[model samples]
Target: MADDAQGATTPVLPPERRTAGQEHVPGNVLVSIGALLLGMLLAALDQTIVSTALPTIVSDLGGLEHLSWVVTAYMLAATAATPLWGKLGDQYGRKRLFQAAIVIFLIGSALCGLAQNMPELIGFRALQGLGGGGLMVLSMAIVGDLVPPRDRGRYQGLFGAVFGATSVLGPLLGGLFTEHLSWRWVFYINLPVGAVALVVIATVLRLPPKRTRHVIDYLGTFLIASVATCLVLVASLGGTTWDWGSPQIIGLAVLGAVLTVVFVMVERRAAEPVLPLKLFRIRTFTLSAVISFIVGFAMFGAMTFLPTFLQVVHGISPTMSGVHMLPMVIGLLLASTASGQIVSRTGRWKVFPIAGTGVTALGLLLLAHLDEHSSTTEMSGFFFVFGLGLGLVMQVLVLIVQNAVGYEDLGVATSGATFFRSIGASFGVAVFGSVFSNRLADQLTDAFRGVRLPSGVSADSLAADPRGIQSLPSSLRPDVLHAYASAITDVFLYAAPVAVVGFVLAWFLREDRLRASVTTPDVTETLASNPVERTSYDEVCRALSVLGSREGRREIYRTITERAGYDLRPATSWLLLRIKRYGSVEPAVLAERGPVPLTVIIEAARQVEERHLATRAGLDLSLTPQGEEVAERLSRAREDSLAQLLGDWWGPDRPTDLVQLVKELNGELCGSEREQPYDGGPAQRFA
Candidate 1:
């Protein structure tokens, strides 16, 4: 289900549930998971690590006009490549593809570190984004291959934590490296970490070979990529590198429009469209996409410039700039976490995006008021308000989309939401860059009109090297700083209207009853760590697993026993299910598998034997003939109970794959010794 190119309409089991030639032991699974996490960290960190370093990088590399491309190139490549990687992994095996992605990322990272010019760094960053896309998609998909659906929730939080940690750490680390070490170390840092992951994956990761037929949608993918590229080029280069009406910019705009039409036409006929055009017909999805784009535009665009504002306008070190950005990060984290929790508890969600966008606009307006004399406290307050607004909206967009679509469109809708946000991010940076460059050029020219007497100190040089301002004549320094402050603040001033549009659109979103599967806060999806390339069945399983975990471990067996209509003790039912799954269970082996004491295991074994549900022979318990019948009934009951959690999804016409998934999950859930019930508690202890 996780590997399914389409949604649950298809009939592929999730990777971990597939029949394995050799089972992965716990230790091996742990080590493999570590490697995958490291890979994910590498991809996630790169998203933010370069922000604080961008000013220094531009100073050293000398193309201030092209600064946004460094971030834009990576985002564009990653967004375009994400779906392709998931589909390719589905067609071929994932292990080799995962390894290949790591190698490509490392190679790109190395080249990025070695880049001597802005163009070279931008090119290398795109190469890294190509691999980074795979790392983001496949790492999450691979988790499905390593752990059973019943246990997946336990690890999902870890992936979310990785993204959360990187969001804070990336900027700080980038600042430290740039201020203390060379800025080149920002790219070079991926080497040792990626190498460890590469080695660990090669040595420890193993999976059974599996393949499926898929229409790759190569044409649709290409058209979309081309369209994005042209549009971004137009945005980033227009009015800065070239006039907006120049032949080159006009050509790109026309080409982008044509490609977009072609993309829509192609998607109409493609066996599996890169992004299904049919999704637009769903009003909720369409509105969510628009709002998501706006949110990305405001959030990432603001983030890109804040560090520059701090370093240039405030005359702060890169490291201090990173530290100063913490208020926004904290506000974002707090608001997202709280909003998610509130939605999960109340099932109400429409208010968040509206409030978020409103606050975002207010924050942007406040930011526009910042000048060279703005206090740190005032700047931090504005940043916090902006982040708070973003946090309120970011996590809910995906959840609402998931609830809005039917089972058939689940996977595509989720990915589609993420895709638009990424595209918006790319556009945001480029548009912001275009605006900043044009404004800065004009402002710098005006400020230095007749006062410049230094031989080499011109407006162009000041724009290229912000660090050179320290050496400027005292009389000229204030004007230069004010020019930078206004240019950056004007970016936020212009962006506030975009946020207002989002606020208006947010009102149009018809709130739907949240699905039980979506109500549980999936930190991975909410945090945007895992690209949810999963079917409806897979998505449900992950959510239910997390829900079940939250319901308390000891109580799960009891609930299952009651739901199965069993009068037997929870421990007896668990033992019978275990024996039914494995054909035979030894008390000692059962004890070794979990924290359940030998005495509890023996007691459960004795209870089953007394009930004639099992027969003991040579310290191993096997089901009796009557026991077999009861066990089969119990298994069906367990599967039915699991199915009941799916709500309307468990209809009479449900797919065979879903039925199979439920049965597989039932076996795994019951087989987990760690979750075994201790009905009598400490009183039953033999020791």
Candidate 2:
């Protein structure tokens, strides 16, 4: 019957059940865990490792002139490649794609270390980012493949910790390499780490392959990358390299804006779009990714300025500035590790990110109080506090993203999240970094005028080196000091509003948990194509939940699905109520009256499926010749077990030990016996 209200075209599931691969799938899941974790390590490592080395990279390559481009190149490459990697993972199997990414990253890292100039480094870094981007997106997408979301609690937490550890470790290693070894060694470091990750992933990650048709959105990718590169270039370089009104800068900015509009139009019409606009219909997925972008923007934007502020405003050396970042890093490590373990134990994770974002915003707000007079101790407290917030949210959101979508969509869904965050971070660094520099220059000029400084001093030169201000002739030093102090303070104050934007976005964030993994791609539509009655336990649950919207109906459906997969009919009303609510019970010694317990069906199913009995479809409750014999034997055993359990609770005079007596009693009462009367008199009915 077509159910018009439910849009009755709803497909009924067939009798066959589903799984990740097939029966005894846990072994496959266990094997997959390593590959997923390896991918996670690769993804998380890319973000943090590059972040830590950027300053040293700027110094060694003499690319402060093109400093923002270094990070932008990676962001552009990763964001552009994110969707493609996802589609490929879905088509070719997750394990193979993950291993390839690790190998590719290793190759890129090796080349990155050999680069002689900024352009070469940028090109190599872009390649590395393309590979690293796959790491995060695919790791999460594979998790969707292996684990049913309902049981994904522990894995999500483990993933979160993997990401957190990478973030904290990136800076620590970056500082160590830059201080004690050649700056080029920072890029060199990924080679060894990536080799190890690759080895672990290759030996353990196994997968099943079935190819599906998919087309790459090459034009869309090109347009998106071009727009991002141009926009970021203009945002990061405007007023510094080229005046805001200059023809070259204006032309690039306008071109980027126009390309962005074209990308949207092309995506809308493409046969196989990189980012399907339809995915936004999923409320949880859409909202969570938005929040992720906001968080990434604030986190990436702030980290850039924090070190600069320490060095420029507080007169701290580069190594010392890195050291000062320790409290925040430590806070992130402890919070993320602890929260992940806790989420695994409790199977509850949504609240942590929500709360953490709120607190993080508060910490950023407090940190905004920094000025030249702000003590290092005060700064440490703020960093640690904010780091605590970061630790709570970052990795958890990715888990949430993975959980909200289906398995086939996992690659694209996860990459979509990574893409948004990448885009947001690029936007943040370009915009905020530029604003900070502009304010610093402006303050330096104003301060010099108030104190009558010599006209020859360049404000930028003074601002660039804290010592440069103090080294100035005494007649000009006081004004230089005031300008440096005020400029740095203005940057922090300006940064406050950006943190507020993140805080508000957090308020609307959705925290969805994992659901059951879809064994088949597009199960909803595929099953609907042959809409009929249910076949599997999951199908039954889905049907009842959707069709029976009245209060308590879902509970009935769920109860039946869990206890009896198919043979789910009730006996006595008492037993029926139990099965409808609390689910099946074990065979017992003393269910002497009332009805049969649910497990009778379980035993029946086991016997029938194992060929001890025959339960052919559409047989109208008639057992086959062999089934008749098996059912009789089962009835006898069930009677005995029930008698034993009910020995004290039921009638003391009832036969409690003999299987024959139970068989006779059930045969007489159930109309199975040839000699049974139509009904027992009132008192016997109770028995």
Candidate 3:
């Protein structure tokens, strides 16, 4: 029982808690998860897949001026629509919404493939983004419906791994599709994959009906979206499309300011604000938000421009550019995984962001030195350093924000933190584009001055079509390449100071005792995918489930047995708990459900019978009176262990709803005789 993040003040019991004697495990959990993963892959892959394709897209569409909007439009729509998707899914059900999202995404993808112009493609990308946001939020939320809290962590990691794999594969796949086929294939590829996911989800997925009453913050969502649009317009179009002092630019800046003020006022009164005003009051949340924003700004801005440099300045093919970018991806993955493990072990995390920001600043400076003549070794080293810095900071921000807020605030706080980062990415790409455009124009004019151009060849033409440089007289080509190199590296030089700001901000972050539930790093969160919509209860459950998973199954039973003051083997304790929950268990059925061998289960059964803890009737085993007492003790010990993991939240003044949730989760953890907790893999077995 916990407040739904959307707006429910009262706790609504989960379906399993409300139902009397039965639990609501999905009929085919793995199949349902497979469908969900596919949905997630669609969203995650889209974020990166388009980056490598953008250069080709702009060249084919003949609008280098509108290049950034291709990425920005999708991000803007997705960020604005994310919170609404979560609320709607909670009110209705996720199954229909998830399917609807897939349909919308596929339609947009089709439209984008068929687009004949840049404006048309940008518009279609926004439409795709609308559905993409739902796919991301709902996929994670639906996992809570199908899996119990104790096993949720094991499955959640799969989602994280999907994000990680997509981050690497997306660019490579995009390059492949664009090179071997047409650039349109980048959008077209989502069709077959999405269709399969749609069919599988419609067939295999199921969930209990949910009809929760919650207030949707319509005005607040609109105001924020309007504000983001105004700012992005000013950044993308101010200098290039309109004069900085032009009415269009000034009006947009003013409108953005007015919208920000109105958004704050609307959020103060709305029942369920898109982003709660109260959270900004928390120092840790505020600082984390700022730092997350800066991280996104630097990270995405560089990612957007680096490919342009590789493709234009270095004259690399799209496929080869993606291959060249692998060092950065590897660095990010290795650093994030390592930092997460270290934090989980030491419970000390303040050092990472500080080091991360400092190294990120250094990396940006290093990238600023790239030119047409820079070696592959030099470029790879700089890219790796930048990724390492990002990996260090990105994952820890979510952890600190979640650790800082109360349970009621946890859901909003987590989403809010990522929301700022998303917003920053929009700003970063726009601003980077603006700077590159303006600087490129000046560099081209300067390079072309005092030089005779062939008929119809001009600085403007060269700026718009990078491929045009190859046809230019050889003497003119170096100037064009240098213009591009300087323009791109200047973006990085400008961004380095932003990372420094984050590094300074890291100094003020107060390190609190890390929560047991949040100790394990979720790869999806670290990658900064769309903000997942979850309630306070669901958030805690995920963290705890992940923690429980980190402590292996055999280790968990062994610890519980010791805490319960029993000297029995871990397998015996597991058997007793199983019998107590299900009334009776057949050893053969238990063995079949388990990774543990038939021999191990039979040995456990024999030990219990020898100890007078169980009596056998045919193949079914029943606990004795003494065994019943021991089982109750083990159950309490399990509950106590879970509570202890909560740290301060389990104090004497703990809320009644939280207590109920803990008990409900405990019952679910021990409920199903056929289902066992995920213990890493099938190779793991109880001793």
Candidate 4:
């Protein structure tokens, strides 16, 4: 995080941590970038790896009937536990939890690979998912800890590919195992990969414990987890063994609904609620969460059927099916990485999510029309477009939500977002599964109307079973194939409408310009409004949303100065963002990973002081009454500019466009330079 703009020295954290601006380290930035990237990879991999294996797993274990449960179990376990992990990580530390997740996932992976049956496999997959949940969340939370949102795009880009890539790789590996080896190898693969990630994280990642003392909200956790589990189960079971109208299904739905209401009530009274209810107050966070659920709905609805269509209808081997999955992976990687760079350079994020979702909706339209006879190229094209949309929205939403809330609430915001997406995915699977199964069963009954059926074939067995497609006789197989293909197409047709809903949600995302100079003090002031919450290296080179600016650290400093009264309390995180962003303007990102050294910031400050441009007394970060007074003055000045600049842009919600405009202006060569000097007049002494 670069505290200095284009080599111009400044403590960027606002409110309290405004630096009298002393402290510096000449080197120690490159290492931090590496760590962030690693953390990101872990999350994306977990998400993608299981997609291709479902078919092989279902067929091999004689559990095609319970295939949905495999995916559902993972989604439920991971999402239900997300808030708990994020809150604990914030309370204790990020790196600690990040490492812990890797270990947990490793164990679960081994168990999944070793399972003797589908029932056993599902249990292990749930364990793996519990650990996997922490990977995505902790990485995002840690990025908030060290990098500011404005310049996070570049680093986000580097790590963003993993999200799309994992989606592709997961299928490919699953296919490989299903075709050439056992499908269980898909889970086993995590062992070696997790080991490599663990090594990088252990050596390179670092985070100090927060000084605050707070208790974990046990009751709130139980309520949230119970509600989440119930919703997930209802979604997973609705169309399969249980009817939407069945008492079992309805009761699950009702119980989950009631539990969710109870969770809201309990949180209001808890001292340290797992969910930061206050984050919903922010327009960005609210909109982002809504849209995230839509994205998940659209994505899962389509993905849930692709493998089965390939195996059951097209007769493609699982491994070849994985090969066919590459188009989407390529598309996701291209869009996500490109979008990340675009956002970083421009500091505009709103448009990406909107456009991404819109694109996804269009892709779904194409898939909805697909049949088994469609050419491979045509199918791949649909997947590619779908993948691109997913890529654009995935990381961007996390960054947007994190930026919308206070530092302490970073974990809560991320966890909340993740939980919703997980829930949405489960919901999509359930709703569409019911629709597909009903359609397929009807089609099957009609196709076989005049033909004599085999001895054990029964409608009750077919409707109650997830594996009915695999049981048709060769004479009736063609009919079943046609039904399966039509059912899948129908599922995507419904998914298209779900995506359209997300597009509507995206339409409302509010775009805000990032402040070029954020003092640490500013984030602390956020604590004044939000008393609620808020690590990692891995595979420490890919996942932390790395920003190339120290501005957030400056804001954090400002917040501290405003709340607790201090300017530029010693920290190494500020250097990470600043150096990562402008350091390229200065030099390449360092290869090592960790927080930038505090002395580096001090020395950089010393360099400024020696140059004789800025003075110390007014500029230095300290806890005296005068510092607080200065903070009030600075806050008002910044707010005044917000009014002046934002006043002219009145019309539709141009969130993405607005952010881009601000990012460009803050950089050295562009837009807002002429007016920038207006706000900092005597504020130059601090520089």
Best by lDDT: 3
Q: Rate the local accuracy (lDDT) of all candidates.
A: 0.81, 0.56, 0.83, 0.59
lDDT of 2 by residue, 1-687 (tens): 111121211111111323324332344465467656765665565665555566556545644445555666766777777667767876787678887888887788788888887889889888987887677567755654454322233354466567556655766666667667866676777776677667766665555554556776888878888887897888878887789999989999899989989998998999877666766887767776676666666667667667656765666755577778878878866776566556544546768766777777777777767777788899999999988887677556655655666533554665566566667777767776677667667777776655544565567655443445556787766566556555545544665565566556656656544332211111111101011111122221222222222112223333332433334222221222222111122223113221233365445344444553333333112245654443344334433432342233235453332333333333222211111111223222211
Summarize candidate 4's per-residue lDDT along 1-687 as a digit string, tens digits: 333223322124322331121112112434655654554555455555566777666656665555666776777677666666766786677778888988888899899889888889889888987787777567655654454333344444444455545556667777777678777777777777678778866775554444334677878878877886786677667766787799999999899889989999988888877776887889888887788777776667566668878777788887888788778767766776677557656778888888888889888888887886889989999989998888777657765765565434554675567556766776776566667767777776777788887788765454444356567777777776777788778888878877778778887887776432211111111101011123111111121112223233455434433543334432322322232222111101121122234455565445433433223444332222443344344334333332233333312553453444334323321111111211123332212
**RMSD list, candidates in order:** 5.8, 15.3, 5.9, 11.4
Model 3, position 366: C-alpha lDDT score: 98
Q: Candidate 1, which segments miss by more than 4 Å at Cα?
A: 1-27, 450-452, 519-532, 535-537, 552-563, 566-631, 672-687
The alpha-carbon deviation from the true structure for residue 374 of candidate 3, after best TM-score superposition, in angstroms, is 1.0
Ranking by TM-score: 3, 1, 4, 2
Candidate that would win on TM-score: 3
Candidate 3 residues lying further than 4 Å off, grouped into runs, are: 1-26, 552-559, 566-571, 585-611, 616-621, 651-657, 671-687
Which sequence of candidate numbers ranks them by lDDT, best first? 3, 1, 4, 2
Error of 4 at 502 (Å): 2.0
Winner of 1 and 3 under TM-score:
3
Name the candidate, 2 or 3, with the larger TM-score value: 3
Candidate 1's error at 458, in angstroms?
2.1
The stretch of ten residues in a row with the least summed lDDT in candidate 2 is 524-533
